[model samples]
Target: MIAQRKDDHVQLAVEQQQQHSGRNQFDDVSFVHHALAGIDRPDVRLATSFAGLSWQAPLYINAMTGGSEKTGIINRDLGIAARETGVPIASGSMSAYFKDPDCADTFSVLRKENPDGFVLANVNATASVDRARRAVDLIRADALQIHVNTVQETVMPEGDRSFSSWVPQIEKIAAGVDVPVIVKEVGFGLSRETVRLLESLGVRAADLGGRGGTDFARIENGRRPLGDYAFLHGWGQSTAACLLDAQDAPIPVLASGGVRHPLDVARALALGASGVGVSGTFLRTLLDDGVAALIARISTWLDQLAALLTLLGARTPADLSRCDLLINGELRDFCADRGIDPRPFARRSGGLDVPHEMTGSTR
Candidate 1:
């Protein structure tokens, strides 16, 4: 039953990708071009550190699928892509393995395929400390992602109804787990309060899995007999809004959900994301084009990211924080309503003037 459900999730997620059409918050955030900048493409760096590990690229392949033979194949291909591209990869929820130990190989294949690369093990908030450790050991994960998906759970037909012990459970797991723990969201974005609360619980980082990528509510609703939950389709904060809300958070904030291309990744980095995760887009590419094609695509994204950084006058992903951004449209309205000041983002460059020669222009 669990394997079948995992298979269903893979199929539905693919369908969502094919049918996905709409503007996301990424469209609202634009970069301020600095023609006076003197930066070269070879000087741009994409390396980043998150969840207590160094990443070759700020972008990683986020959690997608595992647990069944078909999904296992997907994981294998994703693992190969991650290995070839030198970015981290996360497994889908390993709750299935705990239910039936026979399903362990499905999740373990990630480590089997990418033995030298960074891997993150995933579980829900309800998991016990023991299970969390087992999950990390199953994948030999460098870090663990404890996903808190209240919205996904509420919408899931067989999802958990109680949520009283989630915080305490997370605290316990974070305290007991040997590796760094990253509290993640499935699709619903985490707010400022939630990020602070996770920091308080001693979690290492927060993956703000903001809405706009894969819609779990729609997926679960599709599994139902009636499909009556269409109204809850766009129920949570978008990835851009969530990043704005998390500006004051002291812990490292990673961005996922709605991250489609290199420019979106650059936008997230400019907005203070320590790392970015791409799931639906990467999954669609691998499934549609094959592993070699996916590798080529990711490789191209890495090069494009470096080029984008150079264009924005930023030398590295972290330097993106210093690049000026124009936050307008719905995203600007979001910052206003959330009481987050958007002025600072616009003023990051401090209005410096560069010489004509430095700008590569002859006046």
Candidate 2:
């Protein structure tokens, strides 16, 4: 059953059904460009730290497929790419492997291929401390990603039914694990309330796995008869809006979801993200162009990211928040309605107009 599920995930992944109606919320956000950035592209730095581990760039490979031969090949190639590029990589959920020990090699190969590189292990938030430990040990992980997918799971026909005890279980694992625990959302954006809850539980980092990326609702629903859950296809907030909520978060926020362009990564940093994660897009690149093309694409993205930072007068990821940004369109209203105060986004340049609330439809 586990093996078949893994193959289904891989097969669904191969299809390009990850599209959404979201403007990615990025369409409403714009950064103030400084004509005299002063620093050269070579001077820009993206190196960052998360949970005491250093990353060559402020980017990571978000969780994806595993537990089958096709996925195993993808993981091996992704591992080799991470090894060569010096970027951190994470495996898909390891629950399948734990259920069937024969599938362990699928995820284990990531660590074997990248002996010294940073590899992250993933599991559900309700997983036990022992299971979390086993997952970490199985991959020699530097950090662990506990994905929160209540909505996704509820939508999956064969998904876990009990979710009432997830918080206590998460609290236990967060305290028990030696490695850093990154509480991640699966495509649905994390609100400040959620971040506050995790902070109270002692979690130090969060991946606001916002929407406008892969629609897990669409994916899981596609597996059902007639893809019936189509009405909920556009559920949740965009990644950009989620990052806005994280602006004042006590802990560092790692932004993910629909992070298609390198420029969007810059915008994520501008909203105070400590790092960024890209999954579906990276997977698509690998599946379409092979490992060599995937590596080249990563190189191009890193380069373009540096150039974008230079244009924004940010010499490093740390400098990104200093630049004033403009929040236009419905996103501005989202910030206003949520009490986030979009004024500050424009205040980086001193002052600007704060749009009035729209009475009716907002894109």
Candidate 3:
């Protein structure tokens, strides 16, 4: 069963290679470019830290596939990319490993390849305290991501039905696990109320797995008789909308879902995300081109992001907070309805000064 699940995930990813609902809502976001940019290319910094660890890049490889030998190779190559780029990598749900201990190596290969690099283990929200601990142990993770895919599951023909125990189950896992716990969505973005609930349960961080990326619902629906779950195709909030809702969240927000471009990453950082996650794009890249090409692509992305930072007049990723950002179109409407002030984000660094002073010469 777990093997089939892995196969199904990979198959769906391939089949939907060119399929994106554009529901991630990134269209409504536009960055205010300051051509009076003073930052030099060398001065552009892309460093980001989370859970007490630092990485050369701000983006991490979000979860994708596991539990099968084919996926095991995928994890190996991803681990190599993480090690090469100094970015963290997360495994797909370890439920498969828990169900079949023999499959542990597939997930464990992440730790094997990137022993010193930051690694994250993932599991379902419905996981038991014991299962959570073991999942963490399975990969020697620095942190654990308990994925909450209530909607994703509802669409799957063989998905779980009972969700009443989610909160309690998550609370137990958060309290029991030795590592910091991060609650995540599978592609359907998370909201402020959900963030508040997770915070109440002691979760320190969340991945606002917003829409505008992969369509798991569509993937699951495809597995069915085509028209079974068609009515719910456009479900969930866009990644931009989800990020806006997370502004008031006490813990750090890690934006994921439909984050495909460096501009999207920049937009997410400006809104409220401490860091961003990219999965399908990276995975698809690796699949299309070998690991070396994938590594080169990540390097190009970082360079592009740094160059963008130079243009934004922000020295570092954190400095983007003080940079001018605009949320228009549907995203603005979302903030208006939610009572979130979009004006504050449109500042010369949110009124906070950048740590480094710029030279007098304007670029």
Each model's C-alpha lDDT? 0.90, 0.84, 0.84
Would you list the clashing residue pairs of candidate 1?
Answer: none
| Per-residue lDDT of 46 in model 2 | 82
Put down candidate 2 lDDT per residue, 274-339, tens digits, no spaces. Answer: 899998888888988899988888888888888887777677887888788889888898888888
The whole-model C-alpha lDDT of candidate 3 against the native structure comes to: 0.84
Pairing residues by index, what is the TM-score of model 1? 0.96
| Residue 13 displacement in candidate 1 (angstroms) | 0.8
lDDT of 3 by residue, 178-208 (tens): 8999999988888899999998898979999
The candidate with the higher TM-score, 1 or 3, is 1
- Sorting all predicted structures by TM-score, with the top scorer first, yields 1, 3, 2
Number of the top TM-score candidate: 1
Q: Which pairs clash in model 3?
A: 23-212, 24-211, 24-212, 322-349, 322-350, 323-349
Compared with the true structure, what per-residue lDDT tens digits does model 1 show for residues 161-258? 99999999999999999999999998989999999999999999999999999999999999989998888898889999999999868799999998
Model 1 lDDT, full chain set? 0.90
Better of 1 and 2 by lDDT: 1
Q: In terms of lDDT, which candidate is strongest?
A: 1
User: Per-candidate TM vs. native?
Assistant: 0.96, 0.93, 0.93
